[model samples]
Target: MSHEVIRHATMDDLDALAAIEAECFPPAEAASIYSLQSRLSVYPDCFWLLANGDTIISFINGFTTNRPDLTDDMYDDATLHDPQGEWQMIFGVDTDPRFQHQGHASTLMRAVIEDTRKAGRSGLVLTCKNRLIGFYQRFGFIDEGLSSSTHGNVAWHQMRLTFDEA
Candidate 1:
């Protein structure tokens, strides 16, 4: 983690972000370049990236929404973001395969949680495959079971991390 920086994304990060997304997920699950662009343009502040110098290695991105549950449509629709929404919806947590197991993702997740809390959001929501339930749970996310999402034509489990009122 030496010399690595965690910061909000910019449109300049599109290529690196897309490359990581492709490496970390199958085509069916990976977000398209256009979708990434739209998301970046719409809510760049919601994207947190871990970068070593100019090269991005890991990122956690999502939109804020009042809706309590994650659904399929949210994946491709960047316009749905509501800046003052109660919940931060995590759309993806991607790390470069070369950088996996190095704690970069965890580092970014912690930043995201802290930032979201400071923003006065009620909580965070996300959907993950069965294999990742424990990883997110370590961050205090509670598994809400089968999600309504069919985003990649695969089963997803919804998870939520609600912060205590201040």
Candidate 2:
């Protein structure tokens, strides 16, 4: 098995992606199996997974959007997907515990950022907990304090990485 960066995730990768998600986030914060199906079938280009020797390592997935804000609906609403949307909205980034601190997550994010730019979109956006605001800043994501759309009833900090600046 070879270790290399990959472009897109296939449906066969669901189980591995799910395993990483389970370990990294609570069930409430993680996307569901149905949501994964939606992502795989409808937005394959938006989902990406990295592997080491045929074993899944880390991944990041999201879709392009016309809207600037990342509302809760984007997570569960498959019908709301717009493949041609202007704003590249990222949903999640997860890496296996053993693979942490190895720059795998950052590698996947760079791919996503490049894809968003090639698509000629306006920008990339995401929402994270307050504690993670600084973490994203390191990647050049600017925090837009107090996002309006609440996820799981918690306050989310909206982050944007414009095509021009990021």
Candidate 3:
């Protein structure tokens, strides 16, 4: 396996990030360029990019908030991001289809989990379809069952991973 470098995102990555989001999700589920820009502007540090050489192949992006659950509002409202918040709310874990099954998404997810723990966050939260519940559990996430998010008018399940202090 080739080593992919993980780093924080920047304004320069706007186009690439938007492109990747489009490729990874359906139109109804994808984040718009404007929303992505807003997130990058407010909390780039929370957006982790996994790159193979200079091209980004996968990423895990989210914002921090006191809210324990992942909500639809957090996806569009950058103001909801609280840098000092206790929980990390993941908005997306995207990987280019060409790179699927290569473990890039898992690798990026682990990096996000580690970074969140180091930031002293109480836990990490996210929402996904039932199909992905098992996938997330491999990383210690506890499935909280169906979510209230009607963001894209699709059913979502909320999952959380809490960290214990050493």
Best by TM-score: 1
User: What alpha-carbon RMSD in Å does predicted model 3 have with respect to the real structure?
Assistant: 1.1
Clashes of each: 0, 0, 0
Better of 1 and 2 by TM-score: 1
For the record, the alpha-carbon RMSD of candidate 1 to the native fold, in angstroms, is: 0.9
**Cα lDDT of model 2 by residue, 19-138, tens digit:** 788898787787777778778888888887787667778888888778878988888776777888999888888889998988888888888887778888988899888888887888
Q: Write the per-residue lDDT of candidate 1 for residues 11-52, one digit (tens) a residue.
A: 999999999999998999999999999999999999999988
Residues 98-122 of candidate 3 have per-residue lDDT tens digits of 8889899998998999989888999
**Residue 1, candidate 3: C-alpha displacement in angstroms:** 9.0
Per-candidate Cα lDDT values, in order, are 0.94, 0.83, 0.93
Error of 2 at 94 (Å): 0.8
Q: How does candidate 3 fare on TM-score?
A: 0.97
How does residue 23 of candidate 3 score in lDDT? 96
Question: Residue 121 in model 1: shift from native, Å?
Answer: 0.2
